[model samples]
Target: MAAGVARSDDLRREPVLPPGFSLVTLRESGDAFGHAQAIAAEAGAATLVWVRRFDIVEFAVVLEPDAILAEARLAHYLAMNALADALAIHSPPERPLLFRWPDALTYDLGLIGGGRLAWPADCPENQVPDWLVFGAMVRATTMSPFQPGQTGVGMAEEGFEEVDAVDLIEAFARHLMLGVSRWQEEGAKPAARRWLDRLEKVTGVRHGIEPNGDLVATSQHGVERKGLVEALAKVDWLDRESGGPKL
Candidate 1:
């Protein structure tokens, strides 16, 4: 698998996670997504890997779904919905939180971070994989000097002064659990609708998430679909070398 920056081996204190979640906290330089992937199979479901950093809220969780890989990927939408919902819980009211298609998250028109999903490479699409990993990163504080044309904003810079990394992770976990329950009891429609409602809208186009997790856009030109798996494989928001959000 293509990986990110190699982080230091220094470990950090663990945070109090919800029931069924086992936390593995890494140092500031460690990559939560990468670490989670490395141990996903043996770590079992609900194993959460978190990176301790002052500038970013980075974490990933392991999931074992009963559905086939194709349909199971729709869980990504649930994860995104839960994430956006978590941010909304703490964000200042009226701050617009939006998603840039399959992955990236934006706050007030500025990029914050995004989510990513991964499964076993050898697992067949028709079979339910042994595990799936969902990871997300949110910019809590800006490490670089801001430029005039900068396109991203940190949580701190957006009136989320009281929110911290732990708070976001906790909220995300609870919301994610709620999303999963809703998916199980009420079906995927609720999760799908939550995601679609927050998607960046185009005036002339109508957007919807397919049952298999693809994005379908309808317009005068007819309908177009984008594969969720293909887009996730590219992980547009990740800086391959840095193992962090794109700057």
Candidate 2:
């Protein structure tokens, strides 16, 4: 189910990923997520699509799960958890890293890039899909002029002086491997717990992750279930005009 490299550019150093992980390197202007979705079938599992750039860290990976599409969608949470874990590895002590429910990642109360998932369009909800792509981005530095009092922050602004785009991608790959292994061995609970813990705290509300990746919120009023698929349909953290995370 694995072993392939779609492409590699000469400018950037090849990423040091784990065994079975192939790389597809793109130029700065390329789209990591879309490219991975486009080439997932040929690339097979563990093929990481990386966009070479200085202002942002962009990457995505192909996954082939035994479970059906709905169940496999839980991989989104696992990806997000691994992303946060990777950031934490090089973060300043006690830096606040969080997620905005289904897909957005937040750092120190500011919006950063988040995770996105894709599957073959023809695949049924109950059927196993040929491939799934989990993609993500993080602002390594502000590509545009910074505005005062804005809620968006880049890694440089948050005291990550020693980290770079390659560092993040390499870290995320390692963390991703660990997360997937834990989920496969123990169950979704381990991954779910880590994902839930990183969620921004909601006043007086306790959160639970449903087996199918739904968000179960239990507060004083009652239990409200937010469908994972629906929530990920429109990403609130993304800024369409700028083509990046909202500022």
Q: For each candidate, what TM-score against the reference?
A: 0.91, 0.92
Off by over 4 Å in 2: 1-11, 144-146
List the RMSD of every prediction in angstroms: 5.1, 5.5
| Candidate lDDT (C-alpha), each | 0.82, 0.83
List, residue by residue over 24-124, the lDDT tens digit for candidate 2: 98877899899999999998999999888766678999999889998888889889988998888867767688899788898888887798999999999
How far in Å is the alpha carbon of 177 misplaced in model 2?
0.7
Clash count, one per candidate: 0, 0
Worst 10 residues of 2 by lDDT: 1-10
Which one wins on lDDT? 2
Pairs of residues at least 3 apart in sequence or in different chains that clash in candidate 2 = none
lDDT of 1 by residue, 1-247 (tens): 0011112221233456779989888877888888898999898999988888766788999989889998888889899988898888877787789999889998887888899998899999899989899999988766655778888777766776466677778889999998888888988778888899999889999998888999999999999999888898888887778666676
lDDT of 1: 0.82
